[model samples]
Target: MMDWRTKLLDPTPHARRDYASLATPVYRGSTVLFDDQKAVTDDWRQADNGYSYGLYGTPTALELAARIAGIEDARETFIVPGGQAAIALIYLSYCPAGSHALVPYSAYGPNKAMAEGLMRGLNVEVESYDPLIGAGISDLIRDNTTLIWCESPGSVTMEIQDVPAIVKAAHAREVSVALDNTYAAGVMFDAFAQGVDVSMQALTKFVGGHSDLLLGSVSARDDVAYAKLGPIYQQLGLAVSPDDCSLALRGLQTLAVRLDALEKATLQVARWLAEQSLVDTVLHPALNTCPGHEIWSRDFSGSTSVFSFIFSETVTAEQVVEFINALTIFKIGMSWGGVNSLAVVYPELERPGVDFGGRIVRLNIGLENPDDLVNDLRQSLGSI
Candidate 1:
């Protein structure tokens, strides 16, 4: 038999038929049958076959997980309710009470919030560090440090972290590394190959390119972490709907193509934004002027469609609202990685000492015409 990776990428008959049916059939069930009592007992122990119970996973979810694992070059994959749950699972799996964790300062808002609010209450020391610390992270490791969390081209800030350097630093101290790879969506970066122990993604964004489903996946480099987390994941009763898994599987089929188009168009728009008098700087990893572009270029194969920019002039909340409301092509929404373009303004809710300036706008480029997006931005900026 051919390698599953080759089979997954190739336009083979099996691959097409997997979803060729007008709609990916949903396998809804809470119980699974076995041939006999002995077989059921064996399955209940998870000693044989690919599945045992609905929460453990079904054929539909398994197929999606296999495809994602193949893409990430990981040993196993676990599908969770959403991205935040995936992150939470990693924390819950490894970080015990009285443990310490290193999290990027500019990571997704929820991630920071979880580390600060929930983990802190649990007696876990979650320290926020600069994402650019890279190899220097060795200095931050403590006896209780158990996990180091990273996010490349961070959510709203779009700061690219030096993943390899940080991974090397963490591994030296026997610390596990987890990356919020939702931004790059595994298209740009390979977390496992970069020495990361586990990789997590919000399939809701890129993998579910249509943005019609909410799903998250955690891919473990080897069985160590998988074996440790699998039981916990099962115990938590975390499971994605078979329909959502099927949708994510279908989205994976065309992810590379959709991401290619979106990334190219996004870079074009970023360049145009950089040239505008209203813009102070374009926060994109692909740009040579970005703070961590060298690391991004060295560690990543490509960039995602999402990026942000800072305005030259500080604009009021009302002005920001007007700018967003004036857009014709870009829709005002929360999450990105959809086929439709999106625009959102990041409010100035910085940490006490962290000054990230005032006017930062994040843009999620879609499969839309670049010229039209540029024109829409021009009009919006003019209105502002």
Candidate 2:
């Protein structure tokens, strides 16, 4: 004579199967049943051993996290809903109320917005430092400065920061360094080897490869930092869809190939853009014209498909819009790293420290033929 609850809580569906497949199976569940009541009391906080709860991680999430952790050379990894969530988690995990944090002037817009808007309301002091500060960042550090945020190859502007120098300076002051390594997709940059304490990235961009799914990961270099951040990660109740995790895992298998293809295709387009009379400067880090090109050349093993260029003074506002609108091959939209090419015009956010005199256009090179992309650009610029 069992109650209705006893029948409803059965875990018999997970029957053993003797089948194997190349792909990681998607595990989706909210409740995790145990053999005995005492087993329910076991520690399920970390994903090292087995399933805890769906919110903590399922096999799908753990597989993706392990893969990202391997590339990042980190002790553990946590998956979040999106890149911004990863950024927020790092900020909140380190900077308590009344603490101070330093953010780069060229950081992702949402990151800066969170710091200025929410973190400020919580009594945390958020300050912006120049991307070129490098080791000189020591001067900006204060007694209560608990965290320092770095975004190499600043979003849209594409200015590479001296990560090692900044990390060294931060470590000396007993401060933690967290980086938005989204542009590199954690593959191009060896964040941990370079002394980054916490490496956070948007898996939506490159790791997902396709623009279909959105995901993010935060990896810690050591046990101490992971221990400090783990509780906060759980408290935030951050969870990713198992379907998205499966897609990300699939995308990772081809990451190296896709990244290499993107690098080659983007450089061709960027170099061609630089030659245009209407183009003022190409902001690709691999190019000598970009700021911190030397640092990029030294630290980064390769480049990505995303970069920005400034239009020459001769180009008019209407002309800029006309050129972007006339492009037949490149789609006018936001977000990169998808198989489809995309472009967007940034009308002077007036981001601090860097200046784009004329209209700035950021191109996300796709898997299209470089010749076709160049032809599209030529026709558009010629029409203007």
Which residue pairs overlap in candidate 1's backbone? none
Each candidate: how many clashes? 0, 0
**Stretches of candidate 2 above 4 Å error?**
1-10, 14-16, 42-44, 353-358
45-95, model 1: which lDDT tens digit per residue?
232354578876777887788888888898888888899999899999889
Show model 1 residue runs off by greater than 4 Å: 1-25, 42-48, 314-317, 351-357
State every prediction's TM-score relative to the real structure.
0.91, 0.95
Model 2 TM-score relative to the real fold:
0.95
- Candidate 2, residue 52: the lDDT equals 59
Per-residue lDDT over 227-323 for candidate 2, one digit per residue giving the tens place of the 0 to 100 score: 8778888888998899999999999999999999999999999999999889999999999989899999999999998999989888876778888
Each candidate's lDDT (Cα)? Answer: 0.85, 0.90
In terms of lDDT, which candidate is strongest? 2
